[model samples]
Target: GESVGLHLPTLSVQEGDNSIINCAYSNSASDYFIWYKQESGKGPQFIIDIRSNMDKRQGQRVTVLLNKTVKHLSLQIAATQPGDSAVYFCAENMRGAGSYQLTFGKGTKLSVIP
Candidate 1:
């Protein structure tokens, strides 16, 4: 799905440098989360995921950290490359309320400066 916004906050990182993207969520009942990378004209692709029982999880060059107390989520990219340039979004799985619901945060566009 597309990151819904006309103007999104952007984070620019130098090539080969590490990048950190942050997100804040309101629902405390959320249990699962996933980070997706979306390139222009394409749908978002899964990068990594973390569960509420876990504080952090790693996959390939990406790491996802969750702080339930602060209801904050972060995605860390190691050794950023040109291919990593894209809009990143965090999705939360909201359990209960009769059925499962997934909420998406405003995306951050990461630009790798070569």
Candidate 2:
């Protein structure tokens, strides 16, 4: 089955350091990708997104990169902070017959060590 998965299940970063999370998707047809952050007891919040037509997109303190050639995606965080500790997920949106189907990755837990 087509799915999205992360290269690592957990990532630990020291405070003020930079962190990178990698994800791989099986569906090459997916045209849209999104990165989400989920804090404890909270729902996933949108972080950044990238379209297949482009290779990269940047947000406030984060950047998302897409490599359609290998069906790979990545999220980078600058100056990691305690508040940045959360479960990060990558989602791929594929267009179906009449609607879009969203598939989420298993998620990578980001631990910020102070």
Q: Tell me each candidate's TM-score.
A: 0.93, 0.91
Instruction: Please report the candidate that would top TM-score against the real structure.
Output: 1
Model 1 lDDT, residue 62, Cα: 89
- Model 1 misplaced stretches (Cα beyond 4 Å): 1-4
For residue 81, model 2's alpha carbon misses the true position, in angstroms, by 0.6
Q: Which stretches of candidate 2 lie over 4 Å from their true place?
A: 1-8
RMSD of 1: 2.2
Per-residue accuracy of model 1 over 12-92 as CA lDDT, tens digit each = 999999999999987898989999999987888999889999999998998999999999999999999999999999999
Per-residue lDDT tens digits of candidate 2, residues 5-72?
34648899999999999999979989999999988778889999888999999899899989898999
- The lowest-lDDT stretch of 10 consecutive residues in candidate 1 is 1-10
As a whole number from 0 to 100, the lDDT of residue 3 in candidate 1 is 49
